[model samples]
Target: MPATPAQPSFALPVPVATTVAPPDLTDSTLLDVDPDAQMSLGAVALDSRSDVVYATVELPDGARRELRLDALRPTGDERLPLVVFLPGGAFLRCNKAMALEARRHVAESGFVVASVEYRVTPDGATFHDSVRDVRAALAYLRSYADDFGIDAGAVALWGESAGGHVAALTGVTDGLPEFSDAAVLQGQVRAVIDAYGSSELSAIADDFDEAARLHYRHRATQFSAYLGRPGAPFPEIPDAVRAADPAAYATASVPPFLFLHGSEDMLVSPSQTQHVHQALRAAGADSTRYVLKGANHGDVGFLGHPGTGLPWTSAAAMGVITGFLHRRLDATER
Candidate 1:
């Protein structure tokens, strides 16, 4: 199908993410090149004359990666709040597009948002690499905040599914150089919104039935694709899975949280939200959890349908997310 407009479905442009070979090349057996250089992302960058556009940065690894945000102005005339967005695709599929459009949606409510592209398990990537890229995206956003119409110190984390897992971890465990390097994340994020993502893997619904066990085992493969050896023996699965969890960093210093999940979500159970909510509460971090009725893992929005076909916007959905942003970024007015 052709690309659909940004709404309802929330599908971002998947750029043919591959590296183009330089015109000048040696004739020795066609030359050896990195395969990540051949990854196709199908990323489309567009600007509606709103501050800035998408751009790529050469990481310390010399790989050209993508980051999207608006242009920041030096004048104190327009200091907009910002949110760092992480896209969902089981940590291997999606990119900055879904988060970019979502940012623009909330930006209409007055905030500058940034979309990040992290390393995934597509071909050559590791779990640590994903965390590293997220931290790098945070640092890069801060470095250019003045140029992107953003307030460097007032950024919230917004994400979905696996993306939410990272954002939640990033929000809660700021200042930890191990998972992330954003020193500003310590006290900056007033709130966070996680959409249908895993909050605690340990709380997965009653792992007794064979089907249930296999379902989780399959999900583990996604992480294994990046964090574990494809051919590794089964004995290493437990350690590998534990190492990738975001729950390990849950603490009182983490920011408040807003979790939205469908009661019927098959991928990640609603209990995951409950588990995280419980942790944050014990830690004394402000939190809210909303369970949508009759919804599934697809789109937690209460539009009565999963995609663009839904007639109207879900007020609960928009209200919860925006209210969180306003409270955190704009401080509730007394």
Candidate 2:
């Protein structure tokens, strides 16, 4: 009874509005603006969807694995051209989220960009499996074009390093029976952007400069792993290696290609791209090659990241890439 006597005397403090009101200026000249003045409407807001399963594969051990892709698109109702991106991890892993900011940049440029995941060496996957996975991803996208706001007919392949090789090979071998299966739908690629990707695997080592040769000698093991021929003689060129070369399949009907390689690349060697470019040119295919000066393999130079030596190299590389893309895959009406 004694404790309850004064317990109810406390009062709660009332809330106060800390916001300040704007001064009224009904006829202020500051509000006046030129209606026709050049102004930025603002960048298109991008909508991203991750882990979109594009295909399923049955492994040799009777297990099933689901392949996925990450799509970044502008928020709108209209369908847009799709750029399927294949990332590089020496064919040992496929990280769909790699170079995400770059992909977003592409998305903002009025295209739907999808970074696809393919079976890698860890999954007992070979070059054939990677090719199949990429084709399967294309098929899946085409099949679900409406759902993803994709223009099924207007699609392109953009891959880096190993993925670049796959994209090149896939682009050149379109409609070929050996590279595709009936389970997946087939679609034509409008253009291909090969970024420092290898073309002839066997010749890669030989193509490297003295510095590259010393730095990337381990690439032989990577090649062996990708070909599913581990411990194979590094010097001997296998039939699988030849078949996996994009240059081997270069033809007049192949899609237009834009090859970007760094002059300083040591891992895959710029010569890898040169061989493919030469083959495509010889076959009467439309091909363009640019060997970036002072850039290295998968370094900030090749990927347009901030780095030393010619800071504009990154912007220049991206400008060239985007320009090529716009020419090949025109912006779809949105």
Best lDDT goes to which candidate? 2
| Cα lDDT of model 1 by residue, 1-334, tens digit | 1122344343321111112112111110111222122211123232332323344545445677564443212224476677777777766665566644345556666666666666666535665666666666666666766666667767778878778877776677667666654453445565687876765443343313345544444444554565545544224566665665666667777777887765445556656666667778777777777765544554434333345211112444555677778877773431
lDDT of prediction 1: 0.56
Task: Give the count of colliding residue pairs in each prediction.
Answer: 20, 0
lDDT: worst 10-residue window of model 1: 21-30
For 1-334, candidate 2 gives per-residue lDDT tens digits of: 0011111122311111122122112211112222122122236798888898888889878899999999989999888899999987677677887766567767877889999998887788888888888999898888888988998878899998888988898899887888888776665688999988988776665554454343333434656767777756445546868888899888898889988776555566667887888899899999988766555555333333334223112445666777788888875421
Residue-level lDDT for 21 in candidate 1 = 17
The model with the greatest TM-score is: 2
Error of 2 at 228 (Å): 3.2
lDDT of each: 0.56, 0.71
